[model samples]
Target: MGETIRREWRVEGMDCAACVASVTRAVERLPGVSQVEVNLMAERLTVSLAPGASVAAVEQEVAALGYQAAPLPAPDAAGSAAVPGAAGPDRSEAGGHGHAHGGHADDPAEAGKPWWRTGKAMLVWALGGLVGGAYLLSFILPQGQHWLFLAATLLALIPFGRRAIALARAGSPFSIETLMCTAALGAVVIGAAEEAAIVVLLFAVGELLENVAAGRARAGIRALAGLMPRTALRRRADGTTETVPADRLAVGDLVRIRPGDRVPCDGSIEEGRSALDESPVTGESVPVARGPGEAVLAGAINTEGVLHVRVTRAAADNTVARIIRLVEEATASRAPTHRFVEHFSAWWTPGAMLVSALVILLGPLLLGWDWQTGLYRGLAVLLIACPCALVISVPAAMASGLSAGARRGLLVKGGAALEAIGAARTIAFDKTGTLTEGRPRVTRIIAAEGAAETEVLALAAAAEAGSAHPLARAVAAAAAARGIAIPPASGAGAEAGRAVLATVAGRRVAVGSPRYGAEAARGGLGKLAAAMETLQGEGNTVSVVLADGAAIGLLAFRDEPRPDAAAGIAALAALGVRAVMLTGDNARTGAAVGGALGLEVKAGLLPDDKLREIAALRGAGPVVMVGDGINDAPALAAASVGVAMGGGTDVALEAADAAVLKDRVTGVAELMALSRATLANVRQNVAVAVGLKVAFLATTLAGLTGLWPAILADTGASVLVTLNALRLLGWTPRL
Candidate 1:
C-alpha cells in the first residue's frame, strides 16, 4: 500500500445525476485510484489517488467521459482562493464545442447564452428546417419525398451517433444518446424516414428544455457567492482611505461603510451607529440597530448611517464565504434515498437494454411477429427506458432543498442530515444557551437588618468583581446598573465552584452560594433564612453577601427564557413532535423554565446523563438534540441529528449535524418544516418519474404507441421531474 493524496477539480457540463455516475465510473477504472466523489450541484469532482497515480491520468479519464476538469488550489493558499468567484479565471468558460457526450450541454457558459445562440437550439432549428423542407418537397414531387426525409434523418444522426459511440467506449452504453441514436437508426432502416426526422427534432427540443431547467437550479446556489463586495475601502494610519480588493483585507484593518453600501468584511463597529440589513447573510428581514462595539457580518447592507468598522475576520473566513463552502460540501455527501436511486438506476438502465433485446428476438420466434414490427417495438422500448428521469429524481430535489435552507440561514451538513432531521420524532433541548438566554440577571434583592440595599449590593459586587461566574457577573451588572460605586477589593480570589472572598475597605467580605455564606456568617442567617427559601422556591439562584462574619444581603439571579421559546415549543407540538428540555440546573429551576414553555423537563443531568436520556429517547423514534455549550456536545453527537445554535461555542458547532445561524429558537421549528417539505417533494418527483416509465413501457409493448411517443415519454418525464424538484428552491415554512 502507498500513501494516498486527495485532489479536487471543477467539472463542466455535469447537469444530471447520470453524468455524475459516468464521470465516477471512468475515473474509478484508473489503476491506483482509491476513491471518487462527484457533486453535480457544485460541479466538483474529488478523487483520492495512491502514490503511483498521476493527476494527468485522472483528468484524461474525466475528459473521456465528456466533461471538462480543472485543478483547484489548496484550500489555505489564500483567504478566498478556494472561493468560486474570487480572483481567478472565469470557471464558466467552456472551450471548443461546449458539448458533452450526453444529450444536453450543462457548461456554465452554454447555459448563460441566449436561447437562439446555444448549440442545442441551433441544432433544433437546423433539423426543423430540414424536416420542413422535406414536407414541402413532398407536395411538389411525391416520388422524391422518401429520399429527402432519409437525408434529414441521417444528418441528425451524425452528432447523436458520434456521442453514443464515445459514451459506449467510456463505460456508459445505456445513455440517452445511445437510446436516441438506436431508435432513430432503426426507424430509418424500417423506411419510416419522415417519422424519424420528426423524432430527432423533438428530442433536440427536449434537451433544450432540460438544459434550461438545470441552469436555473445552478444559478440559485451560485447567487450566494455574489453577496461579497469586490472592493473594500481600507483606512490607513494617517486617516486616509483607499479602495482595494476585498480579499486583500487583513484582520484589524479599519474600513468606512457608507449608507446603502454592502459591508466588505466581517467587522465590529468602531466609530458610528447604524441599522444594518443582514438578510443577505442571516436571512433577517428587518434591519438591525447596531452601535459602536457591536459586531457586523460581511454582506450586510448599511441601510441608515455612516460607520467605520474594524475587520474581525478575513475575506474567506467571513459568514458568506463559509456558507458557500458549507453548501458545496453538503452537496457532496449522498443521502440514503439518493444512494438508493443511483443504485436502482444503475441496474435499471442495463436491465432495460436486456429486456429490449429480448422483445426484439423473442417476439419474432414466440409471438409470430414480422421482423419489422419486432424491431420497431424493441426500439420503442429502448427509448421508453432511457432512465434519465428516474436517476435525476433524488439529487435534483436534494440540491434544491439544500440551497433553499442556506438562503434561510438554516445550514444542514448534507442530504443525510437533512433527511434525518425531517423524520425527528422527539426533540431534546439543552437548557442554558439553547432554551434560556444563558445570561443571568438580578431579579430581586433582600437586605438584612442595619444593611441598606445599595450597601449590600456594593459589597457583593466588590467581592464578585474578581470572578467570571455567571452569578458574579449578574451581581456586578446589577450594581453597575444602579449606579452604585464599588470600592476596590484587595486579595480577591475565587473558590472552586463555591464562593469568592475578598478584603473590601479593610473588612473581609464573602459572596457566593447560600451555604457558603451561612458558614461564613458566625451569627447565622437568622432573619434571612425565610427570604432565601422564598427566592429558591421561585426558581432564583441566591447568592448571599457577608461582611465581618455577619450576613448583609441576598442577591437573587434568574436566567429567563427567550421571547420566542414558548411559541417555538408550541410550533413543534403542532407538527406532532414532542419537545423536551435536558439541563444540568437544579430540578426546581429547570421545571420553572420548562413549565412556562410547556416542555417536559429532565433536570440536574451531567454530560453522561444527557447521553443516557438521548439514547432512551431514541427508542420511540429519531431524536434531534439542540444545544449551544460544550457540555451538550456528547448528546448532540449521540442523537439522530444534532443542531447547534449559531451563538454556540465552536466545539458545539463542530459536533452538530446542522446549525441555525439566526440564533432563534423558532429556527428549530423552521428547519424541521423545511426538511419535511423537501422530503415530500422528492417523493413526488420519484413517483412521477417511475409512474410515467411504467405507463409508457406498457403502451409501447402493446403496439399502441411508436417511436415519437416513446421519445416523448423519456424526455418529457425528465423535464417534468426537474421542474418539480426546482419548486423546493422556493419552499418556505407554513409557520
Candidate 2:
C-alpha cells in the first residue's frame, strides 16, 4: 500500500440512503480509492485515496451521480472550517443535474428557503400544470388526447431520463429513477399515455415532499451551529473594547459579555460575576452562578452581571463547535440495523427487477394474458420494486435521533451506540465521580460529654485552617456553614497521614485521625471511641479534635451522593435496567454510597476487575458502563456502550462511546429512554416501507393495480417512511 490521504467534501443534493449508496459506488470505482463513506444527514463524503488517486477524481465521480461536491478544508485549517450550513454557492447553480427525481437529488441550498422558491418545487409545479392541462384537454378533444398526453409524458421524462442514465453508468442500474423512467416509457409504449403523465407528475411531487421532510430532520443540527454568535466584544489592553468576529477570537483574548448576551468563546471569568444560562450548550434548564475563575462555555447566555472573560479556547475548539462536529461526524458510524438494511436493499432491487422480467415474459404464456396486459402489469411491478423507502428507513431515524440527543446535551457518538444503549439490561457506574459528588463533605459533628459543640468545632476549624487537605477543608467549611468562626492559630504543623497540631487561644489543638487523637488524649477518649468506631463502620472518615491532650469532639466526613443519584437509579429501574456501582474504594465506602442510591455495589475492584465484571454482565445481556475516571476506561470499552460524564478527564471522554454534557446522573436514564424510542421509530419506518411494497406488489400481480397506482404506492411509501422517521426529532425521554 502507498501513502493514503483522507479527504472530506460537502456533498449537496443527497436526501436519502440510496443517494449515499449511489455516491459511494461511483467514488469506490475510482482507481486507488481505498474507502468511501457518505453521511446523508450531514451531506458529507469522505474518501481515502492512495498516492495514485486525486480528490478531483472523487468529486468528479460524485457529480456524475447527480450530486454536487465541494472539497472541505483540512481539519486543521484556520477558523470554523466544517460548520454545517457554512456559506457556499447554490448546488443547483453549480452546473450539475439540479432537478429532483425519484430518490436522486435535492437542492440543499433551498434548505431554509420556502417551498415555492426551490427548484424541485418549481419542477413539481410545472409538471403538475402540464399533466392537468393534458387531462382537461382529453375531456374536450378526445381525438388529440393521446398526442397531448404523449407530449406531457415526454416533457416530464427529460430530467428523469438523464438522471437514470447517469446512475446506470455509475454502477447503480436499478435506482428509483431507472424504475420510474422505465415504467413511464413502458406505459407510453402500451398506449397508457394519460396514466404515464400523471405517474410522472406524482413521482416529482413525492421527491419534493421527501426533500422537505429531510430538511426538517436536518434543522436541529443546523440550529446548533447557529448558536455560535457571529461576533464578539474583544477587550483592548488600554481599557478599550472593539467588536470582532467571534471566529477570530483567539486563546487568552479577553472578551466582555454583557447581560443577556451569549458567550462568544470558552473562557474563564476574569473581571465580574454573573449567572450564566448554559441551556444552549449543556441543556441545563437552570442558570448557574459563575464568578471570577469559573469556566464558561461558548453560547451560554450571561443572564445577570456583566463579565469580562479570558478566552481559554479558540472559536473553532469551543464546546459548541465540538458538539456540531460530533453530530456531523456521527453519521459515519452506522448502526448494525442500518448496515443490515443497506445490505438487504443492495440485493432487493436486482431481485425485484428479475421478478419483474419473469412477470413480463411468463405471464402471457402461463396466465393466458395478452402482450399489452402482461407488459403493463410488469411495468407496475418494476415501479413497486424500487427500494427507496426500505433503503432510507434506518438512516433517517438514526439521523433524527442523534440530532434530538445533541439538543438535550446527550451526545451519542453514532447510531451504533444509540442502538446498543436501548438493549442494555445492566448499567455499571463508577462510584467516585459518577454517583457521588466525588469530594469529602462534613456529615456529622459529635462533641465529647460536657464540652460545647461550638467550642469543639471552633478548635478543630482553627487547627484545620492552616492545612489544605480535603478533610481539613471539609472541617473548615462545616464550621463556616454553622456561623462558627476560627480564632488565631500559631505553630501550625502536621504529621503526614496522622495529625495537624497548632496553638489556638493559647491552648494546644490537634485535629487528626482517631488513632492519633487517642495517642494525644492523656485522659483517653472514654465514650468517644465508640462513636468513632460507629462512624468508621458507616464509611465516614472520622477525625478527632483534642484540646490540651483531652478529646473534645469527633468530626465525621464522607463523599456524599449527588443530588439526583437516587432519582437516576430509580429512573433506570423504571425502565427495566438494573444499576450497579463498580469502584476501587473499600467495600464499606462503596456500600455507603450505593446503599444510599439503592444500587448494587461491587467494591474494591481494580481496573481489570471492572472489565471482568463487565464481561460477566454481558453474559446475562448487554451492559452499559457509565464512568468518569481513567480507571474506568477499560471497563467502558469492554461494555456494550460506554458513557462518559462531560466533566470527566479527556481519556474517559475519548474512551466512552457517548457523553452526557450536563454531568447529571439522570442523563443516563434519559439516554437509554431516547435510544429505545429511536429503535422503535426505526422499526416503524421499516415496517411501513416494506409492508406497503408487499401489499402493492401483491395487488399488481393480481391485475388489480396498474402503472399509476403502483407508482403512487411506491412514492407514498417513501414519503410516509421519511415523515415517520422525522418524528424522532421531537422525541423526549419520559423520565
Candidate 3:
C-alpha cells in the first residue's frame, strides 16, 4: 500500500465562485481527503487522499453538492489516453447543471445549431415568446382577456420556479436563481408582469453566454494535452521493427524517427543526423542540429534527416510529462495575493446579502417609495453581489502564467516561485557549468627538475579516474585522447578543497592546489614559483604536482565562457537585476570570466563563503542563486530563491526552488519577463473585477440601474477578466 496518492478529475456544474467554495467544503468533509484544489477556469479538481481511499466516495460528495466529478483519462502504454474507470458523460453534452438559468446549457451535440434549432433553448424562447405576444395583445384586448397575459407569465416561470424551490430546500436560499424567482413573483403581485418576464429572459440568456466563455477558457489548457504523439516505430536488435506506444518505451530502447515526425521520447541520437524544431519544448523558434550523441527532448519535431534514438527516460518521466504535471499543480500553490483574495471573498457574499436585506427594508421608508419598487431595486443589488468575477480573477491569471512558463522550459515550482522570479533584485551565479562550458582543457604542463611531463599527466589522470568532478573528467579525457595509458593507483583519496592523493607506480603522488603541493613537498617549490605565476596571470588554473615529497610539475587549464553568457548578463542588467559570480576557483580565473561577462566577482571562496555572500546580497533585496553543482547546493538554499540548470547535479536540482530546463543563462531572463508579465496581468484583472462591482453597486442604489443592467454587468465582468488573464498565455519575452 502507498502512503498517499493524488488524483485529478474534471468537475462540472460550477457556475460561480460560490459553487467553488461549496464543492471544496463538501469534499473536505470526506474521511480521508486532504489538500483539495479546485480551478474554476479549468473546471478541474485535484485531491490528495490516504492510500486505499475510495475515489467513488469523493465523487459522490461532489455530486451531493450539485456538481459532477469524474476521473480524468490516464495516458497509457500505447500512448493514447484511456478513461481511468468508466468515463462519465461529457459535461458539455449533458448541458448545464444545478441552477443554470434557461434550464439548459450549451449541448455539445447542438453546439453549432442556431438559437431556434436547439431544443431546450427553443422551448425557453417559445415560452418567452408566448408571454411577450400576450402582453402586446393585452393593449388591444378586452378587460376580460387581460388575465390571459397573466397565464402566459405562469408558463414561462415553470423552469426557473421549479429550480428556485429545489435550491431553497437544498439550503441555498439566496442563490441567484432563487432571487430571480422571488423578483418575478413580486412583479406579478405589483402589476409589473411584463417587466418580470423580461428580467427572467435576460438572466437566462446572460448565463448561457457566461458558460460559453468559461468553456473557451478551459480549452486553452486542454490544447497542451494534444501535442503528444500516439504511436512510435520501435526497432529491435534483430533488424526488425514494430509499432509501439510512445509511453511504453524504456531506457536504452531504440526508436526510429523520420522527417516530419515528432520525437517519441527524451533520448540521445544513436545514428544519423537531423535538424530538429525544438520550439514546442523550449519556446524558441530556431532549429537545432542533432547528430549522433546529441540529446533530444520529446515533443520536438524531426524536421530533416532520419534518426535512430536510444531512449534516456521512461515516457511518464519525459520532459513533456513534467510540463503537463507542473501546469496542473500550479494553482495548488497560491500566491500571497491570491490567498488574501480568497480570504477576503469568504465574507464577501454574506456581507453582500446582509447589505441587500437593508436595501429592501430601509429603502421604502427612507426614500418614500412603495414596497414593490424597493423590493425590485434590492433584487438588483443581490444579482450584482455574486462575487464571481472577484473570486476567479487571480487563479485564472495564475494558471495561464504557469502554463506559459512551462511551455518555454522554465519550470517554476508554484505561484510563490513565479512571484519570486520577478521580485529578484540580485542574482548570484556559480561560475563553472552555469556561466561557462564547465569543460577545462590542459593548456600547458611544466615539468620540474628530474621529472617528465608524461609522468605528471599520467599520475593526475590515474588519481582523477574515480572522481566525477568536471575538472577531473576533463583531465582524464585529455589523457585518453592523447593515447596515454593510465596506471592503476592504490589507496587513492580526495582532500576537500585541496587535492587528490594516491600511490602510482609505488610512488606517492598528489595533484591539487599549489599550497597543498608545497606543503606536501616540504617547501621545495621556490624554483617553479615564477612559472606558476605566469600561468595564473594568464587566467589559467595552475595545479601543482608533488611526488614523494618533491615538487615535480605544474599543469595549467582553461575553461571557456559560454557563448550566451555575456548577452544573458546584459539582459538581466537591463531588467535592473545585478549579476554576481560566486566561485571556488582562484581570484584570477574568477575575475577573468566575470570581467568577460561584465559581472561582480567573488572568488576563491569555499561553499560556506558563498553562502555568506548570498545572505549579504539578500539584505539589498530578494536574491536568486543560479548554480549547477553539488558544491553550490548550500548557496542555492541560502538565497531567497534558487535556480538550477537542467544539466546540473541531482542534488542541485532538488535544492533549488526552480529549474531552467533549457540549460542556458538566457532562461533566467525569460523567467523574469514572464513572471513580471503575470503580475501585471493579475493587477489588471483585480482592477477590472473590483472596479466594475463598485461602479455598478453604486449605480443600482441610486435607482439608475435595473435588473437587466445589473445582471449584464455581473456576467460581463466575469467574461472580461477571463479574457484579460489569457493574455499571458501567448506572451513572449521582449529579449
Best by lDDT: 2
Order of models, best TM-score first: 1, 3, 2
Model 3: lDDT of residue 603: 85
For model 2, which pairs clash? none
Q: Runs in model 2 with CA error above 4 Å?
A: 75-99, 102-112, 442-533, 541-557, 647-653
Write the residue-wise lDDT of candidate 1 on 1-735 in tens digits: 768999988776676777787888778888988679888877788889898888999888777666778787774644545345232333232221233544334444654456556666677788889999999999999999999999999998887787677677778888888888888888899998888888888888777677667766776687787788878899999999999888778888999999999999888899999999887776667788999999898888999999999998887777777787778788777889988988888788788889999999998899999989999999888888788888888878888898898888788889999999999989999987778776899999899999999998999888888665567778889989999999999999876435788999998998866767777788789999889888878998777888888898888889889888999999999999999999766577778888899999997676788889999999989999998845577888999999988632344335689988777788899999999998998899899999988888999888898889888887788889889989998888787
Superior by lDDT: candidate 1 or candidate 2: 2
Model 3 pairs whose backbones collide: none
Sorted on lDDT, best first, the list reads 2, 1, 3
Runs in model 1 lying further than 4 Å from the true structure: 1-3, 74-78, 85-99, 102-112, 365-368, 444-533, 541-555, 647-654
Candidate 3 runs further than 4 Å off? 1-7, 12-19, 39-44, 48-54, 72-207, 366-370, 489-529, 544-552, 629-631, 647-655
- Clash counts for all predictions: 0, 0, 0
Give residue 268's lDDT in candidate 2 (0 to 100). Answer: 91
TM-score for each prediction?
0.87, 0.85, 0.85
Highest TM-score scorer: 1
* TM-score attained by model 3: 0.85
